[model samples]
Structure formats: structure tokens, C-alpha cells
Target: MAFELSPLDRELSNKTINENGFSVYVSGKIKIDRSIKDIRHPRCKGKLHSSNLTTASVIISFFEEHWETLLRTVASVLNRAPSGLIKEIILVDDGSSRKYLKDELDNHLATAYPSGIVRVIHLEQRGGLIRAKTAGAREATGEVLIFLDSHCEAGINWLPPLLDPIAANYKTVVCPFIDIIDANTFEYRAQDEGARGAFDWELYYKRLPRLPEDRYHPDEPFDSPVMAGGLFAISAKWFWELGGYDPGLVIWGGEQYELSFKIWMCGGRMIDAPCSRIDHIYRKNSTNFPKAEFGDFVGRNYK
Candidate 1:
């Protein structure tokens, strides 16, 4: 759904866009538990999952994320997912400078979710996304570890599809069909049918047209050459076996390719679950954020 802003809201939205690279004003107007239309294929509606699926610990890493968007990401998971399947939700704060993110966020989670299902880990020093996620995984106790961006909304019945395949084959790594949330208007919409994850010679992330056989089975999980990096689920056991992200790789650049190659070479496989849909906020002005100086890290990691 898209929101219509007033003249004053537009001015505020523009300010947020300049600051956060997205419309924080519009995101603030959205309900924490806002309902998004189910855009999955018809076949996905009747699919059945194992009754004894393994539990998952969701880890979200943030630096200076917008308040409402982060809260909505939490709310969407709590509201839409089955409670029994979620072991915990861990918020990894990668040295955020925002005052509200410190004590205010902790207090809100404590009061809002008195069950203590949600918790926060504030890094005293800035650990890049790779290390932040690794820290979260080390602290996670669930059988599976699911990594998500700080500003994403979980789609209806998203967990079961992702878990079902992994439950059957613990060596499998699963990625969801990522939909786009408009950076300016806050409109929720589908990206497309689907495509295979791939990369060109330069090692930049790219998508290949789905094979003819994959097009014939739109609702089933299909093999993907690489992951888009932000959203994916891996068995806790398999993740550790693969040694998580390379400790030497700083910040985020070629980690997706690194993991994708590890999955294929180490007697494991990566699959894209069509039934699992996740909406991600693609920011407009990413250059506004201060860049961490990790010179030649992408080239070094890719090597």
C-alpha cells in the first residue's frame, strides 16, 4: 500500500530522504502491524510444511536505521510468523549514533514484548555488517539462523516455506523472493516472477533469466547460483560448517558471492524459495552514509 502525504509531511519527508536516504516520515505514518497483500503464486497457497520444523533465530543488523521502519520489521515478524518457530529476534546494533536507538529501543522492546522474546546487542565498537551478523549467530541458540536487513517486512506465511525445505535437507541454504518497498512513496509491490542469482566476470551481483524447467515450477524452490546478500536462511549447523562469513572480509561487498561459492563447493546447495516473499526498502541515496575505509577489501575477499 502507498501513502499520500500532506504539504508539511512532504517537506519533512524530503528532509528524511536527505538524511536517511528514504522517506522516514512516510514510514512513521505506517502502522507497525500494517497488512500487505500476499503476492505469492497460487500453488504456494496449498503447500504443506512439516509439523516439526526447526526453530529460527532472526538476526537484524543496523547502523543508523529509521525508528519506525525498524519497529515495523520487528512487528511484521511477531505478527505474521508462528510463535513456536521463532526462538528469538536479535537486534545487532553496529555502533549506531542515534540517541533513541540506545536506551529508548531497549525500553520499548521490554515493555512491548514483556515475554523477553526480543533482545539487543550493542557493539561498543563498529563491527561491519559481516562481523555484526557473525556475533549475532554466535549468540543465537536456534537450530537455524535467519539474517534480515533492519528495514524489511515479513510477508504472510513466509517462514514455513523457507523452513520446510531446510528441514528436509539441513545442508540447504534458502533465500526468499525479495520484493521492493518504494523509497519515496512507501508503496509495497512485487519485484517480478523470479530469476536465478548470478554474477558476471567483474563479480558484481546479477540475475539470470529463470531456466525453462524453473519457469514450469514457479511455486517450488529452485537452485540459485548466488544470493543477493541481505536476506537468507541457513541451518545453524551448516552455517558453522561453512565457517560463516570470512573474518578477514570487512564491511559488505562480495560476501554474498563468497558464501554462495562456499555453499556449492562444500557439499551444500543454495535454493531460492518462490513461496517465501520478503519486502525490502531499497534506499535512494546510499552515498549519504559515511563509508568505512576498507581499501581493496572487496578484491581481497573475492580472491
Candidate 2:
């Protein structure tokens, strides 16, 4: 007798039945998010866990003009990453103009790093960061995937902190404390030295040093309902399981908010780890890509 597929499974199968050659099968009674145990570190049996948490892949999505900065960012990662970590670095070129990044970019990266782990995926047409990130995520092979912008600089011990929470079977999204650097002079500033990151209804981002007097503390691990997507890490399985970044968003704006909300409301948690810190270039005028139509996207996401 042929097994009958439930409505949710049928929907998921349909969604993945296209040219991608991958299928997403969802079950109605089984909650995909809760089915898996909490994220945890691997055992030291000298054997790889089926969960695949030993190594990590970093995704850096960049546009045309920021190629040089992207190179520098990758160099920083290579310089600071602890030994025997980082399985690979996936660089997604979201339609760049520089001949170096397209034709000779990979060669240059190979020459610079010489580790043979860096891979580049060039989009023939510009898909913006949202699409670029999705493309990179799809290609990522590591068990844990960390997403960072092209202009950010990695801090010492940055890689492990992002993966530690996930390794511990927390099943929660994790982000590090992000510091800002002046775009012109590269002067670094710690925007949130004492506190973790937070968000507000205004959609503005900030760091909260202390919990409010009336707020409830359950005595569990540190948890935040929302986190800045500028630098966040998650297991590759959970990422795709959460449906990845909403393809509905255009360019770069509401993607982070969507991930933050979905993780919390869908019965997962988001945390800000004070132990990890990354520096990002803050600019008065962004020269990377064209101004995105983020207002309409935000409205659609919120509504």
C-alpha cells in the first residue's frame, strides 16, 4: 500500500520540487523546530557525530565595490580564527563590477590564503544581499554556519563563541556583541561594551546593559527574543528548517527581523553572547549597493 502524505508534507514537497533537485518534506503533527534536541557540543570519542558539529563554514556576501573590504574581512578571519576550526569560507559575489573579484578573485583569494577552503559563487545578475545570502547558505557544507557582512572585522576567539552555544544543543540563534568602526579612518568603537544587543519597536538597534526591574528572569540561560542579523550564527539544518531567510524580502533590510521573530515565536530562542565581539565599518554613506526599497518590504513583513 502506498503511504499517504499529509497536507504539510505535500506542501513542503511541492515547495522543493522545482529545479533545485532538493525536497522539503514537512509533517503536520511533528513540529520541525522542536523535533530536534537542543544544540550541543560533540563528544570526544575521536569520532565525528552524525549531528556534524565539529567544523563551521562562514558566509560573507559582498557586492562589487566592497570586494577589497571583503578580502580584508576574510584575511582577518583567517588571522584570528583558532587552529583546527573553520571548515571553509563561502564568498558570494552578488554581481560585482571589479574584474578582479569575478575573473581573478578566486585566484587572488587562493594566493592570499593558500588553504584551498575558500569558494566563490558569482551571481550573473545582482540579487542583493538577501538572495546572495540564500545562495551562499544553500552551498554551505559545514554543520554550523555563521553569517557575516563583507565589511566586518573578526575579533579574537570570535569563531568559537558563535558555535559554542549551538554545539551545546541550545537550539537557539546566537549573535555576538558588534562594535562599530569609522568608515573614513577605521577608528574602532565599542558600542556595547558592558551589555548584550537588543531591539525595539521603532526597529532601531541598541545594546541593553541591564534588565529592567520588572522583567521576569526564569533562571535559565541568557536569552533574547531578537538579535541583530549583521553577525549571527546557527546550525545549517536549523537555518533551512526555519525556511531560510524569507525570499519575500528584497535586497537588505527586513531579513534579520524576520529571522529574529520567527526563531522566538516559533518556540526557539535567540541569544547575545558577550564573549564574542566583531567590528563593522559604520559609514555615513554606503557605497556598496543601490538604495533598496526596504520600506515596502518591511511593511509586507510586519503586516
Candidate 3:
């Protein structure tokens, strides 16, 4: 259900876009615990997961993220995932200058979840996304470490399929089939087609046709040479064994390819769990992010 905005509201939303690179006004209007479509394969509806899937610590790193969308992401995860399987939700603040993200965020989470499933880590300096995630992983206590962008909404039954594979083989890494969440109207929908993760010669992220065998078992996980990087689950032990993200890769660039290739070459595998769907908001415009001082960090990381 979409909200009808008044003329004044529309004007405000446009202004909000300039500030956050998305319609924060529209995101604020939507219920924090709003329901989204399941958007999974037909066979996924009745698929059974292991009764004893390992617990996970979901780590989301954000800097200057919109308040409403951030809250909604946590809400969707809490509402959809089984309480026992979620050891904690860690929000790593990458030195956000925004006042509201400071005390207000801490107070809200404390009041809303008295059981303390959510924790926030405030970095003294802006360590970029790569460092922020590594910081969050260092404090995680769960068997699995799940990384998600600050603006994603977990679809129905999104957790089990991801954790099940890791439970079977600790070396396996699983990523959800990411859907698209509209940046403007905040509409939730599926991506046009399903493709496996791949990369070209220049190390640019690319997608290839799903294997022919994938059609036979549409609900099962399939091999992906690389992960989209924004959302995925990995065993905490395996993640640390692989040394997490390279400390040298400042900000966001080629960490996806780095981690993906490392996983394959180091005798581990990456898969896209078909039954697990997570909706991500692809921004209509670039946010007012600070430029990284590190020169050619992308090229350096790829090298």
C-alpha cells in the first residue's frame, strides 16, 4: 500500500532526495514494520530447513544513513527471522556526524528491544565500509556472521536457507537472491531475472546466465563465482580464517571480487540461496558521501 503525498509533502520529498539520495520522506511515511511480498520461488514456499540451523549475528554498517529506512531494515529482520536464530543485530556507525544517529539511535533501540538483540558500535573516526564491517565482525559472538546494507528488507523465510548451507559445511558462504526496492515510491519488487554472480577481466562485477541445472532445482542454492557483497552469510570461523576483508582496501571498491576469488581459491565455495530473498534499495542518485583520500584504491585493491 502506497501513501498519497500532498503537494507540500511531494516538495519536501524532493528536497529529502537531495540530502539522502533517496526519498527519506516517503520512507518515513511507511510503517516501520510494513509487510513485503515473499517473492521467492514456488518450491521455496514448502521447503524445509534443518531444525538446528546455527544462530547468526547480522552486521550492518552505516554512515549518514536515513533514519526511517535503517529502522525499517532492522524491523523487517526482527519480524521475519526466528528470535532464537538471531543472536544479535550489530549497527556499526562509521563515524556518522549526524546528531540523531548518536544518542537518539541508542535510546530508541534500548526502548524498543528491551531484550537487547540490537547493539550499536560508534567508531571514533570514519574507517570506511570495509573497516567498519571488520570492526563489527570482531565483536560478533554468533556462529554465523551475516552482512547486510543499512537499507535492506529481509523477505519471508530469508534466514534459514542461508544458514543451512553453512551449517552443513562451514566453508560454504551463502548469499540471498537480492530483490529491488524502489528508491522513490519505496515499492518492493523482484529483480527482472535470476543470474549467477561473475566478474569480467577488469574485475568489474558482472552477471552470467544461471546454469541449466539451476532450472531443475529452482529452489536450491546454486554456485556463484562472486557475491554481490551487500548481503550474504558466512560462518564466523570461516570469515575470520579468510582474514575477513583486506584491511588495505579503504572504502568500497573491489572487496567483493577480492573476497569472492579468495573464497574459491582457498578451497571454499560461494552460493546464491534461491529461497532467500532480500530487497535492497538501489539509489536514484548518489548520496553526499565524502570522497576517499586514498588514490586509486580500487586499482590497488584489484592488483
Candidate 4:
């Protein structure tokens, strides 16, 4: 499957924010490689295996995302992920208002993923990430449901490792080793495979180094206290049965912990698989997200 965006796409993809919230960058049309290979941990290479039984539908929720970033996200999945294992790619538009995002995106996907592998779902009104992901999950047909951020790029052979444990036990919810993609330069970088997501009482997440026990088996999946939330995979049956994501939670804050605690309290376990890795663009929420528009929704979670 080949992808070539039109001149209009290249122009829109070159869009950058250098104002108050973001770092300074030039406006003279920058070029980024769409087919950059991701760096993976050497330990994750030959030790992993996949099953033909447990297939997945990857759900990517987006609001008013950069035209190029969103396209690259989907392309990464197409380029790295196994076509047969990936039943469908669901792109959820949370009522975006950008002119370039509307018809142009629809037409782009129509050509890029013409094999009916990609499905674009447009919401009539804004529902934030929670609702957008929920909407995407509702439309998923695969046995396992995978969720990724709009700016994420999965590494080579990233899918099988995440699904292997799920195939063994469907109730397990798994997250890949999330690496940081430089927000400004679009450079793909690797992270310590032992690092996992953690947060404090205030619900702010940060990467914490793994303890001695975590490195006991570098190739094995380590149990995690919490997930980064933007990327993870859960069984379709368990997700709906576990009530999906909290419908009451708004925007993006506090949702990760909510799901984390939900999984633990309900006898389900969350694991961070070292074998599966993905790169996500490290963009600041203050500039790239829609949380500010729905700020008061944060109060709803506490109430």
C-alpha cells in the first residue's frame, strides 16, 4: 500500500504553531520523511511471536490534528503492522472545524487506504477524546480493540507482541513501549524498555524507571501500576464488559488513572509489554489539544 499526499496536503502538513504556547519554527515549508524506520530495542527482535487467532481493530481518535501528523500516524500502522492481523483502522473525527481537515481528509483516506482497510467516522458534535474513543470502539469489529493517539507511529512487528499475551489471556489489557518523537524535528527516538508509566495522587503521569524486579525478564511483560492512557489495547469483550472508558470523564485528564484503577479493582491486570514499541510525537497539550475548550469537564470527574 503506497501513499502520496497532494500539494495541498504538503502545504497543510507544513502547518506549524510558533506562537505563545509552542516552540519557534520556520514557516517556509519544512520537509519530513513519511517512511522513516523506527529504532527498536534489540532484545525485542527475535524473542517475540504472534498468533493468527486474536486480530485487532486499531482506533485512532483525533480532533483538529495536523493534516500531515494524522496521515503519518495511519501510514505507520499500514507500513509496520501486519495487514491480516489489522482488521481495520478507525479514524474518529471529533467534530473538527478546520477547513483542511474536513473534505480533504475524507478524500485522502479514500485514496490512501482504498482496500476498505481504513474507516473514517465523523461525529456530528465535539465529544472530546473519551467520547471519540468510545465511538471508535463501538464501530470496531475485530476480537481485540487497539487504541492509538493521532500522532503515534508503531515500530516494525509491533502488533504481535502486544497481542500474544492477550491471546493467552483475553482479560489482560496491554500497552506498548511508548517512545518519544521530537515534536519539532519529527525525529524518532527510543526509550528505555524498562521505563513504565506512573502518576501521583494529582493524576499527573510521568515515566518511572523500573525496579530490579521489573528487569527480571527483559523480554517478558511487566505488570504496570498505570498506563499512559493515549495508547493501549484491550479485548473487545472485556472492554465493553468492563464498561469501556468512563463516559462521565471529560477531555483527557484523569482518564488514565480511572481506567488503571478500574482494571485493578475489577480483578483485571494491566501490563506494559517490552517487546512491543511505538513512537508518539511529544506535543504539548496546551497547544495541540482541545482540553482547554472543555476545561470545566475536569470538575466533573472530581464531583
Candidate 5:
């Protein structure tokens, strides 16, 4: 089901689309000042357990992203995740032209980080998503490295479950189930069942089906083979050894497949942890990006 927008929502949406070429502009204007109490899945609660010793550094990268939604992302992590498990939060700005994301964000965050646990790094050149994320990953000092979209909200107790897999084997890359948050109304929604990421020969990503027989227990992890590029957690050591993301890639699209293949080739496993969750604002763009940049993804030479 889609979110119903009110008049205020419509106004904000129109303003946002004009700026970002999508609905995230509306998310920027949204005030998530108070905690989002009900956007959680029923399964997220009820006796959740996670590894306390497995600490992590959450990295978020963005270019011209919304402000309010970004802080909500950090706030959700702070409010729900165990303090000891979160070593730090790193925000990387890929040459954002926006004024607020710079000093305004730094100043705003200055009061927030007394111990210097959270930081904002600015790049002079616009290094697309892949490079920008790599910049954040380079600064990570935790055992597990988590990469989250700048416009996402953390689900209750999400970090521990993602780290649980890596603690078993450093070669595991674990991702939480993603919930949907409306771009216009900011309404949160969850899927009835769980699915994993897959891709076609055309290089297009799709949601694979889930089977009940695959589960030995209600909260067990499933093999995704691949995961959405926007969100996932991997061992810091393995991520660096596997070469983080392909530096040859520019912007977005093909990087997910590139990283997925590298993980499989190197004897690493990718899992979808349903017990952990996060809400993402699925970006929608009516027109395709410039062909010069993204055309290679669909070309016959993709093999």
C-alpha cells in the first residue's frame, strides 16, 4: 500500500522533487524530532539478543541529501542500538553544494559529539557513491563496518543482529531486512514476508522469493547471495582485503554486483538477517541517468 499525502505533505514533496530529482526533498523537510514509535516490524521486538563485544563503525555517504532525515538516521541508531556496540558514526559528504550539509551540519553535530565519536568528512571533489563510501570506510575504526544510506532510519536493535554473523566468521557480510518509508508522507511500512537481493543477466536487481522450508528457526539467517548496495554490514578486515568497492565504478548501479561477486569468489558468505531491520526511502527517478555514465551497465560487454 502507498502512503496518503496531506496538503502539507504535497507541498513538501513538490519542493523536494524540484531539488533532488526525487521525493527525498520531502524527507529533508520532515521533522523527525520525536522518535518514530510505530514504523517497526512486529518481529523486531520480543526478546532480541545480540553480541555486545562486536563493536562497529556505521558509515553514511551522501551528495545533496536531506538534513532532517540524515539526523533521524543517526538518532535512530543512537536510540535503539547498544551504546557499547557503536564505536562511532561517520558521515561523508561527496562535495555537496548545499550549505547546511557543511558547516551547519558540522556545528549541529559538534554539540552531539562530545567524545568525538561522530564526525563529518567533506570531500572537495564529487566522488560518486562508491568512492564516497570508500572514503568513509577508510576512516572506520571498529571491528565491523556498516554502510547505510544517508536517508535511512535504523530499526530497533538492528546493529547487534548484523554483527552476530561476522562474529562467527569474519568473511560473512550480513544485511538486515529493509522496510519501506514513504517519500512524500514519511509513513513507515514493512513487508509481510522476507526476501533477498538478486540480479538478472541484464544487470537489473530484483527481489528473490522466500521459502518457509529454508528456515530452521523463525529468526535464522538466509543466504541472499547478493544484497542491496545501499545497506549492509561486513567485517572491516574482509572489506579491506576484498578491496572495498571497485574504484573503477562511478556513481551507482553496477557496484552491488561487483562487490557481491568479489565476496563469493573469495570464500565469503552473504546473509540476510530478518531479525535485524532498517527503513529506507526507496529513491524513484522518472528518467534514466545520463547514458554516458550508466550505459555500460546494460551493454553486451557486461559479461
Candidate 6:
């Protein structure tokens, strides 16, 4: 007897067919008794092992003209990363006109690391950083997600510091101490005499001189007033649950400030680890201002 399927069951069946190319139907009832293994999608056939689940996804979002810097950043990550830690490096190209990034990155992936894990997502139109990050976040597959700027260079054992805190059940956001790179030459340098700092109401990020006692207690972990978005890690679930980065912010001014403040004000703590470090080149002049009109949005969001 062919029983009529309800709208809900029909919708589910359609989705399953579209996603897995197989639909579940019981012998006579509406219950779905088929195993996912029975799906006929060519990509679904495999002797899946649980060991493959230990992978991590690293996401980097960048715009035009940062291709070389991003390549160097990925190299640094691959060099210092522990074996069996990262599963994939996701590069979200926010409307870059450069053709070499795709060519160079593909060649490197083929010869250097052939895990078939390097994925590139190119947007047809330029979306700001928050949108780019959100797009990359939706496509990530690792148990843990680490976010880094396109121009960051990682330190030794950098992955462990970020992952360790989350593995120990810290749902809050984790960030490493960022050292600065010379804007002119892209050469890395130690933190300046006055480097550790946060953003003010004016949306300008400024550094303050380390306290005399700060040098004496270099080994101690302390609560930070804000987490720098250049490098931070969080469990995949919590990130989406908190609604991710606010999609309302424009190109690149105050999105980090909004994220840091959201994490602190909405029941999550931000911590800075002295043990982990990354170098970011500070551009003396940035051309990221979308419009003079959008400046008010920055003030309202951070104020």
C-alpha cells in the first residue's frame, strides 16, 4: 500500500535527496529507517574513521593587494604548526583582482601539502571583513576554528596555545599577544616600548607602555580589557551562537572593537596569552574607508 506522505515528511525527503541523493522511507510507515551509509552520492562512499575527526580549520580573510603577505602567513602557519592539528586552510578572497594568488596557492597545494585541504572561496563582489569572516565560518568543518588576519605570522606552538584553552572547556574567546611588523618593509620586530594597548571611543587603536611590573611578571596570565581580533580562537558552536561578527559594520574600522566588547559584555571573558605570539604588519596608511558617511556607524556601534 502506497501511503501518502505529509508535507513535513515530503520536505524532509526532498532535502535528503538533494543533499545525499538518497531518501529514507520505512517499509510502510513514515519513519526513516535507512542508514546514511546507503546514500548514493559518489562523495559519500568511504570507510570513515573517527581518527579523521581530530582536524582543525584555520580561516583567513583578505582583500585586494594582500596576496603576497597572505601567502607568507600561510607558510609560517604550516611551518610552525604541530603535525595532525590543521585539516584545512580556508582563504576567503574578498573580491581580489590579482590572478597570481589562485595560481600560486594551487601550485603550492599540489606539490607541497597534498592533503587536498586547501580551499579558496572567491567572492564576486567585495564584502567587508565581517561578511567575509562570516562566509568562511559557515563553510568551516573542523572541530575547532581559528581566525587570523591575512598578514599574520605565527610563532612556534601557536596552535596549541589557542586550542589548549578551548579544549580545557573555556568557551570564551582566546587570543595571542600580537607583535608588530614594520609597515614599510614587512619585517617583523619585537613589540615596541609602548605596544600593548586597546581601542578608545574614537575607534583608534593605540598602544600603551608596558608597566614596570609587567616586565617583572611576564609569566603570569592576566584578564585583558579587550581581545585583538588579528588572532583569536573559539569553539565553532559558540561563535555562531553569539551571532558571529555583526554584519552591519562597514569595511574595516571598528568591527574588532564590536566583537571584543560583545564577548565581554555578553558573558564571555577575553584572555591574552603571553606564551603565544603573532606578528602583524601595520600599514601606515590604509585605504579602507568605505565612505565618510559611514563614520557615524562606527561611532554608534562602539560608543
lDDT of 6 by residue, 15-109 (tens): 53332122322111321211111111222133222332345688998875444456667777776767788978888887766676666756765
Model 5, CA-based lDDT: 0.78
What local lDDT score does residue 77 receive in model 4, on the 0 to 100 scale?
82
Please report, in order, the local distance difference test score of every candidate based on alpha carbons: 0.90, 0.66, 0.89, 0.77, 0.78, 0.63
lDDT per residue (tens digit) for residues 1-303 in model 4: 112446664444345443212122411233323555546656777774754558899999998777766777887787787668999999999888877778888887788678888878999988788889999999999999999998777888889888988887888999998887665455567766657678767656788888788677887888888898889999999898889888888766678888888888998889988878888767643654554567767666755
* Rank order (by lDDT, best first): 1, 3, 5, 4, 2, 6
Model 4: lDDT to the true structure: 0.77
Minimum summed lDDT over a 10-residue window in model 2 is located at 32-41
| Residue 24 lDDT in candidate 3 | 89
Clashing pairs for model 2 are 38-169, 39-168, 39-169, 39-170, 39-171, 40-167, 40-168, 40-169, 41-167, 41-168
Residue 270 lDDT (model 2): 80
TM-scores, all candidates, are: 0.96, 0.74, 0.96, 0.87, 0.88, 0.72
Candidate 3 structure quality by residue, lDDT tens digits, 1-303: 455778988888888887787888899889999987778888999998898899999999999998989999999988998669999999999999999999999999999999999989999988788999999999999999999999989999789999999989999999998888887778899894468988878877888889898878888888998888889999999998998998888878888888988999999999999888899989888784556576666677777
In model 4, where is the ten-residue run with the lowest total lDDT?
19-28
Q: Which candidate, 5 or 6, has the higher TM-score?
A: 5
Clashes in predicted model 2: 10
- Return the top candidate by lDDT: 1
Evaluated at residue 228, the lDDT of candidate 6 is 55
Q: Of 2 and 5, which scores higher on TM-score?
A: 5
List the candidate 4 regions with Cα displacement exceeding 4 Å.
1-15, 19-33, 288-293
